[model samples]
Target chain A: MTAAATGVRATARIVARDDGRGGTSLPVLEGDGPLALRRTRGSGDEAHVMLVGAMSGPLGGDHFAVRAGVEAGARLRVGSAAATIALPGQAKGEARYDVRLTVADGAELRWLPEQLISAGGSDLRVTTHADLAATARLVLREEQVLGRVGEEPGRLVSRLVVRIEGRTLLDQELDCGPGAPGGWDGPAVLGGHRAVGQAVVVRPEFEDRPVSARVLGEGAAVVPLAGPAALVTAVAPDALRLRRVLDEALKSLG
Target chain B: MSRAALLVLADGRFPAGGHAHSGGAEAAVKAGRVTGAASLEDFCRGRLHTAGRVSAALAAAAVLGVDPVRLDAAADARTPSPALRATARKLGRQLMRAARATWPSSELDALAREFPKGAHQPVVLGLAARAAGLGALDAAYCAAYESVSGPASATVRLLSLDPFDATGVLARLAPELDLVADQAVEAARECVDAGVDALPAASAPLLEISAEAHAAWAVRLFAS
Candidate 1:
């Protein structure tokens, strides 16, 4: 309950720069506590990195963060080894995870993390902020599973904010599980669905020829933002179905 | 300033083009999620806390003298569906015309000139409230009440449900409307200092997804 008792305060930082041979390389890879970073093999101009959870955490009171930057002409792809599960801990305070990403001009970043499962009796808050240059390309995806199989959810609040050239492209928050405001799981909100996911694609090419807005399926939709980006949002009865909806939408975006 | 202004702005027949849109209720009804008064109440409650809360906060902020341009951008940020954004702007434009003709304030005129096409409806609603001499809480109440009322009224026509039942739904939600309006005022106060980022960002994913689908409906009763 106290600030000191609130778990670990750890941050992982990564920097990707141009290799000058038509490729990209990571010069800075640092992670602390349970937030482990590993650079894996990548082909061509893209560098691949996988986030390996050093330990089971993001439990109650735990504080974690990941920061990544891609310089001009460099490309980086980040993924997780497995799903990040929020678990209840000894402390009563909620856990916090912050992801800050930056892509400079002519740079590219693909941030595709696995689902975040909010287990029963656990509480977590996640904030992901991405700042991109006008010419930067980004493919960011987020998926959340309310609770494990045959379990009730705790509390999970997630916020996603994306900006380009100092202008707001998209900013939204979703609060689900226990203690959230009323009607969150009702017909107009989740409609009894347990899984929710969204993908955002931004490219300079979209500025010239924008993506048309349309409904993907019964539970998904793709809509163009004010900037050169498109957002796909989908909700399903389960994670597998949710991924199917998002994957189908991504293929159409291509 | 005057309490009567809230009544004028919140009236369903204000000619702001809200009659054509069901605020996502049409899609819910078609999806079979809303079968009767009970389901309608459930749907309206969800909408009120999410989309309704966001709108009330924006309107309250506008009445508190926050810049309309900034609030308009903030509104755009909260609304992900292009169809919903277009609908908001169209309604904002219509409300701007009515407000300018009725209240005739310089701030409203300036905002109209700035956004020729239109701004977001909540921002315009706040300015309209201010133009009519209403306060922040009043603007918040108007926005919060309208969020549920629009859908309730639309459902009566969509399902041919008894009008009395629909009215009862709104009546039962009156207490929640007061609570949401108070919360909106609190958020608007934060916006006055911390900027629009302080406003609530609660979202209704099903509504956004359904609105996109409804927009493509070759034949539908409501516009959104």
Candidate 2:
């Protein structure tokens, strides 16, 4: 659901620190506004952190950050109130946000949510770095769309890095511009389609058969009917369905 | 093209729809698993060592006139991910059609007809390489290039990484291609002189995971 459009441009930061007792405490700060935060620590070693009605406004190209740390054996569930959109700026023409997460040994982190939309002429750069131990389980989902309703695709560039014990597990850079080649060239990558999203689930080890069966069953809708390429799509009214589909698809992959 | 028998192993128009795949790059990109050009490069490199190497070796064996059935079985054993296996078969079917049109080799035609469900891409590619008069090394290099280029190209669209930068990543991988091709050719020679039972095996768990994950995405842009 869309929150009331606020004109305030403010920064919100949430820091979750492990208490060394297998539980973690979170402190949230949002633009000097009344801090409304909820922390639920589950018996299954899961720490859930939610920020509701935290920030509202055009965001005025404001900066925000979410920092999460999980000590050994503690898991964290991180999410936001709604889909974060980068509204257009008058002069600079774009917005930005940063997210950092760290998971210690035997910890798990699941970061999932709505799409990141960049309105026309809006430029956004989102960078996320996660440090995980050898046995830590991590899942992160990110969906980015350029432009608003009926507007041409905006320029968006995003970078993400996942590291295990200072060793880079994954590093990627994506830039969507007007004159790009290959993947964005219509029928090649996105098939000239708009609104692309992806989710990733990573663990230290898992059997291959179950993972394959899971992907096939969960992604049955989007599995390409022809060729070696695997692509699937469906029109949806909201982001939740899309998120569920992605989560299901990733679970299959795991 | 004859000097090296350039048989287009994974062309975008080849109906294998490999054009729609970024290998595991798409999943990696979506999961925020891949961050910069260097990491993208590593992903490509890792695939070369695992799937890429296997495909190249199989293609090289086909070029050396190894039995298609044995090569196909080896490919099946190496590709533990079902999504990948399905993709390889689809690509194999497409390659068979193209191979029939471009170069009419009865053996390839028979192999395709016999294995109507489609052989693995590497198996089909190896057979096509033999039909095109390419040596084992040339066939292996072509197979390696085709296997790696699809994802390297896909990363451009998935991440919007600079096309020039992406090309540079491929260029940097030239040495890898050579090394992999050499290894593939050697592996092919070993497989042919000995047999599938004598072939070596190596597994990369992450590549399989990424492939499975990419397969599960609901609204993915690429096929694999």
**lDDT per residue (tens digit) for residues B140-224 in model 1:** 9988888999899999999999999999999998888899999999999999999988999888999999999989889998888
Which lDDT tens digits does candidate 2 get at residues A1-254? 12223222334455545557667555443323412345655445566765554544234354445566766666678765666666655434345566778878887788765577766655566677877777777777777655566667666666655667765444444456453222331221232234555444556663121232443232223332111122222212234555666666665454
Error of 1 at B165 (Å): 2.1
TM-score of each: 0.97, 0.48
Runs in model 1 lying further than 4 Å from the true structure: A1-4
- Model 1 residue A62 CA deviation in Å: 0.6
Local lDDT at A123 for model 1: 92
Q: Is model 2 an incorrect, acceptable, medium or high docking prediction?
A: incorrect
* Top-TM-score structure, candidate number: 1
Query: Per-residue lDDT of A15-119 in model 1, one digit per residue for the tens?
Result: 999999999989999978788999999978999999999888788989889999999999999999999999999876899999999999999999999999999
- Candidate 2 positional error at B25, Å: 0.9
Error of 2 at B3 (Å): 1.8
Pairs that clash in candidate 1: B1-B133, B1-B134
